[model samples]
Target: MPLNSYQHPCPGGYQIQAADMLIGGTLGARVNWGDPARDVVITAGHLVNNLNAAVFQPGAGVPGENQRIGHVAGRSPLRTYPSSREFLGTRAETPGQRITCRYDFAYIEVAGDSAATSYRIPGINDTDEPLAVRDPIEGEPVHWLGNTTGIVLGGHVRDLSYWMTMELDPTNAANRQYLSVQPLTLIEVQGTMPTRGGDSGAAVVAVNDRHIVGVHCLGGTTRKGRPFTMASRVPASPQALAEGSSSAGFDEVLTWIARTKAWVNS
Candidate 1:
């Protein structure tokens, strides 16, 4: 609970350890699966889902060297998607509803040179301009950079189509570890800015454009306990919104990290 650097608007916004509870998000774009110069750090499989736990950029009391940013090389498996009819034409507006699209996400793997620490996702600007990926339009106009809501500029997209998240599985037992409503191809932003619960894996761009149209995960108040008001509510107002998981769900985690990268490089 110590944030600085203007609430971590850079260096990918981190903090990890879900078993003992310390979660925040964002830290994307630095890919390359099998050594085209090696780099890897995208996030959000419920914020690193305990791959032994240690990621901390600008996190854990705001310092340096808590900077352990790597390890969990891949995650995203708890499937359940059926927005009724089209898991095969590859979706076309088929929100017939069945729920459980949990490709939450995760990709750590940076072990030397700390993945070079910058790919311009911090409040959006360092200028290599590459990070592209799309699909999220229903109102469009989104932006993000969060440790707990630091650069959320305008955020609008009401629903790119299909959503039903609930997620929170600290290994089940806290009442069977929730992932309840389930179906999410989500892009759902809404603004007046103030995302909470460590802003789980923020990235969401597309306001001025870096292309990326999703990553930030889960925010609430659509009637469950009543307290979610993005200004006057109605980005599609079921009540409150702020979700993400579509860069087309990171192309199936980059095709399962390029088909296991030779068992992660043997």
Candidate 2:
């Protein structure tokens, strides 16, 4: 299905743009791990650096009305520690500067009523099946519905720990910063779908049971010029958001939404 266009009860795998940023990324998944029927929008950390930033859909031919869907709720620092994310730079990175992170994923608290969202991932699992989450298994076939390249298939987890840097580059009207992250359980996929811009934040899923696996964070050529597609493994544990890890890249973000987040109002 064409996901770039506006969708009511916006499901997973749709285009999302931060109102303050010029570019956009995919809202990888609609995970309702709370009391609400449709609770949060999950995506890459860089897209939601500023918590509470307004978020909307960049749908073509769709009128501009009712576009403001939600706001950034939480994010995990993509870099830190020999055991976990702490000590060193633990703040979420911003655009226009290089970032060091351990887990490159974040979650947005969905606003409005339950009708405003759906957990279904179009073309992959349209039913209201209980969405399961897990870490990516190497060599297992996978699928991800990207806003730019819809319904990507024939891919499998290749690398569970790949170091790389992510950047928006020049010409982007907003967020022209660089992101440099360590291995941190980076899930690399190699196969049919050639990762491209706007595909960032796409959720990497297993083809067998459609279990949510990883967050497609970024992709690019290595110093040797070899192309690579990378993602952050889905949270196996979000304990204290990795603040207690004595080793590096051991935790992933998810604790904030595992329970409804109590937003601290100013």
Candidate 3:
């Protein structure tokens, strides 16, 4: 489903549009599938912590431009506390219980209608595969499918690490949380494809097999001034599934969409 400049293999996947009512900004990444009843879209806890509304777009380009598929709500509250250090007097942290930096992940329920359209990797028939820890070998070419440079593709895996840091909240040092120590991977390209502002929550999948290994969580320059991309691994453990409920926000979003679809059909 290639359209315009959006050339990713999974063009139909959901893109997380940050606080912008419109699609076109660096937001969070859409990761994790909580269960069949609720489709979990993982993102930075801070993104949805103070947001008024969160919707899922099945297609690329713009947020509201496509079909209104799903809705999302902040699962937990943001934790703000004071720091002992003089330079950083106040520190705000998201509690792990309420979706904190330890995981740096939040789950959003996908509406019914939208679920059918959201991109799914070819091999992901069930959540049995251990996605949290992928054994991707070094030099194995990988690609990222997201709203990169305006929604195109053709990037390669630059490197893999147990952990890395990206600028989440620039103003507050406390806002920055150590990215969960998972098998985090990076994708790089020359001259840029089409990744632009509003492609934050895109998925980074393996090209050949099309199995989702990571979610595009953040992007920025390296310490040496080189450009790079980053993504968080999806926890494959059942514990991740047991922690959150899928009935409330996620189910409600899907129920509303189903009702709308029925109304339109009538």
lDDT of 1 by residue, 84-150 (tens): 2222224333433222333465666667536445556655645644465555565767666656555
Best by TM-score: 2
Candidate that would win on lDDT: 2
Q: List model 3 lDDT by residue over 237-261, tens digit each.
A: 3365234222113333334345434
> In model 1, what lDDT does residue 130 have?
44
Each prediction's whole-model lDDT (CA): 0.46, 0.61, 0.41
Model 1: worst 10 consecutive residues (lDDT sum): 231-240
Q: Candidate 1 — which residues are off by over 4 angstroms?
A: 1-9, 13-24, 27-119, 122-124, 127-135, 138-159, 173-175, 179-200, 211-214, 218-266
Instruction: Provide the lowest-lDDT 10-residue window in model 2.
Output: 257-266
lDDT of each residue in 1-266, candidate 2, tens digit only = 44687777777788888766667888788776432343677888776657788778753223574466678776665432232122222335322232346677777777663465677887777887547777777777777877877766446565565554455444653534554454433333454346677887887888897888877877643322334467876544444234311232212322221211221110
Q: Choose 1 or 3, whichever is better by lDDT.
A: 1
Query: Scored by Cα lDDT, where does model 3 land?
Result: 0.41
Count of backbone collisions in candidate 3: 14
